[model samples]
Target: MSSAQQEEEVLGKAYDGRLMGRLLAYVRPYRWQVVVATLAAGLHSVTQVVGPYLNKVIIDRYLFPTHAPGSHSLIGNYLPADPWRGIASVALLYITMLVIGFALDFLQTWSMQWVGQHSMYDLRRDLFHHLQRLQISFFDRNPVGRMVTRVTNDVEMINDMISSALVAFFDDSFVLLLIIVVMFRFNWKLSLITLAVLPFMILATRAFRRAVRDSYRRIRVAVARINVFLQEHVTGMSVVQAFNREQRAYDEFDQINRVHLRAWTDAVFAYALYYPAIEFLSTLAIALILWFGGLRVLNHT
Candidate 1:
């Protein structure tokens, strides 16, 4: 493998606190935006939880009207007894929740994106300034394309981590925590049954992460190779043409591109398998809930 490919293939620690601290330095300037975004994400998670609860309210009070003793005291007391009015009221509340969720989602996305772009701009400017001050030996050792990729593609990955991945982590954690609380509050037994599949889900997630990591490494190496090949050949295209090496160059490029294509194919395949596995696990959890909850309902226990 070429030096660029080798560099790309070199694995780093999964989580580097020092590196994260460095990245956080960029975010420190816009800490207030991050705070707003995090709050919005948390509220958005609440909106998600509320939707399902509203569905339950619609079923129990308005549509089905169980009228079970002590059950009609909570949400029912606030709602109109007339079915049509109650349904309309709940529908209005749901729409309002949807609107609030939309606004929160937009605010969170915009704020994070704004922070990411500004942070990356500062990062790239620093990188450019550093590059300008580098010694001549540094330029001789590193391929121009590799250096360009560091400034462009690698920095974009950091931006994605900031804007998308970190945000997702926070948002999903909030959703998960809220869902767990709601689930246990509603029925502890049913919640336990639903969560019985947690171990399997963890295993599947680990396997999926491993597969994706390998595929990503391959993709990075392939991309680095392509960049290096293109930089060298394109810059020396006149000499290649003079030497009648067009066919050879084309074949080499074709091979490099095929590696890139195969890497992407592997990544896609991993994702395809992962989503279905997660779906299966989710279905299993739901099935377990239905089976156990159905028994409870039937037994009036």
Candidate 2:
């Protein structure tokens, strides 16, 4: 590995609030887009909660009419006596919510993409400008490939985090919270039972993330090594041919290629393990919901 690659092997903290705050500095100029994205996400979250609720209402009020319009009925006085009318009304609202949610989600996605592209453009321009001002010694110490990767790969990763991961994280959190709230509001006991697997799922997800991260880190190192090898070899191809060292160069390249392949294999293994684990956990959760929530349905609880 190059000295630059070795230096990058030092794994730092995954999150740094101050670093994130600094990143937001770039978005400050495009606050309007952020605001619109936030609004769209917020609207989307509300629809996520409300849409499911409409289905629940359909099941409880229209399909079964558990408690027919009577003195004890909660909405008997306000809603139409005909259950079909009530179902149609709620279904209309559900469709409306779905349409709005789709539009808002699309808007948020497009807006974030725009923000990411623009922000990265500025960031890369500034990065190149700063690199131009750096001392010659710094360039001498770092491989040209590593420097180029900083401008392209590393910056692109950061842009993805900012535009996609960060925003989605917040929106998903809100949607999850809303789901939990709605679930408990509908049936506290059933919600509690369904949520029992959450801790185990969380643990499994954390383990998966750690494993994949380590594997991908190895892959990055391997890829960087490959990049450095290619850059140096291509740049010095004449020197090797002059010395009649083609066989030696080929052997070295073969060795480096194998290392890169092994790293990629490890990453693929991690990915293969993670996704099935997630699918299994998801199926397990569904099974649990059916087993327990089915009991609630039978008992009319």
Candidate 3:
């Protein structure tokens, strides 16, 4: 059997409190940067609604007669007759918001990435130090290939979660919360109807997460097997030739490669199913909005 077929020792959990606490400990040193990045993400989240809300204000005031005269306005007074100045001012403010959001997004990305890189660097260094302190029997028990994976691929996965996924998680969460706030703020009935699809979406997401996790695990195992097979075969090439085992070695490698291909294909299928599923649900939401929300607009309710 290929090394990739070996049983994995590090099993991941859906929600591991101890694991999360340890991860947070690694991030504690850079808590200030994390805070600033979060604040910037929040600013970007709040600013995201500005353009749409501004459009609503402009349409209600200048384009449509949805409200009475002298209602809420960005300027001193909102006169339906004199909407040009108000419209121009609102547009300018909208443009300003876009600019500010751009700056905030840049800062947020940079700050989080900085924190992530530094934290991962420390983690990688620690991993290397720990490996250096291991006994010779440890080396004899574990293959060189598996040890290499520990210091490289596995560490890279942790780095990705710490540096990219963690920040992205917050960014996405804030965006979702802001979307809920904006949807209800604009139209509660439409929002409720649109959100009716959320429970299904969440369920689909949960299934996708579990499936993807298994697929990814299979992929990692397959990759490790291939790496171990290659490393051992290449190092023992002379012995294989002396024993006329080239054909056998080639066959084994082909088998390992096929297993790797199958593993990655499963991952691809998981991704394919998840994204299109989300898009289908999103389309359903939009269809509901157009059907019901359209009626509300037409009836002027």
In lDDT terms, which candidate is top? 1
Could you give the candidate ranking by lDDT, starting with the highest?
Answer: 1, 3, 2
Residue-by-residue lDDT tens digits, candidate 1, 1-301:
5564566888877779999899899999999999999999999999988988888888888777785643453577799989899889999999999999999999999999999999999999999999999999989988888888889888998999899997899889999999999888777888999999999989988998888888888887777778878999999999999999999999999998998999899989989998998899999999998899899779987
User: TM-score for all predictions?
Assistant: 0.95, 0.87, 0.90
- Backbone collision count in every prediction? 0, 0, 2
lDDT, candidate 1, at 1: 55
Tens digits of per-residue lDDT for model 3, 1-301: 4333345625478889998898788889999999999999998988886777788778877777455443354543543357787788888888999999999999998988898788878877888899899899877767777767777787778778866887788888898898898778666888999999999999999998888888778778767777778878999999999999999999999997998788788889989998999999999999999999789668966
- Which should have the higher TM-score, number 1 or number 3? 1
The C-alpha RMSD in Å for every predicted model, in order, reads 1.6, 3.0, 2.7
Specify the poorest-scoring 10-residue window by lDDT in model 1.
Answer: 67-76
lDDT of 1 at 47: 96
What lDDT tens digits, residue by residue, belong to model 2 across residues 24-121? Answer: 87878888998898888888899888876666666766676666332133343565657878877877877999999999999888888788888898
Residues forming the 10-long window of minimal summed lDDT in candidate 3 = 1-10
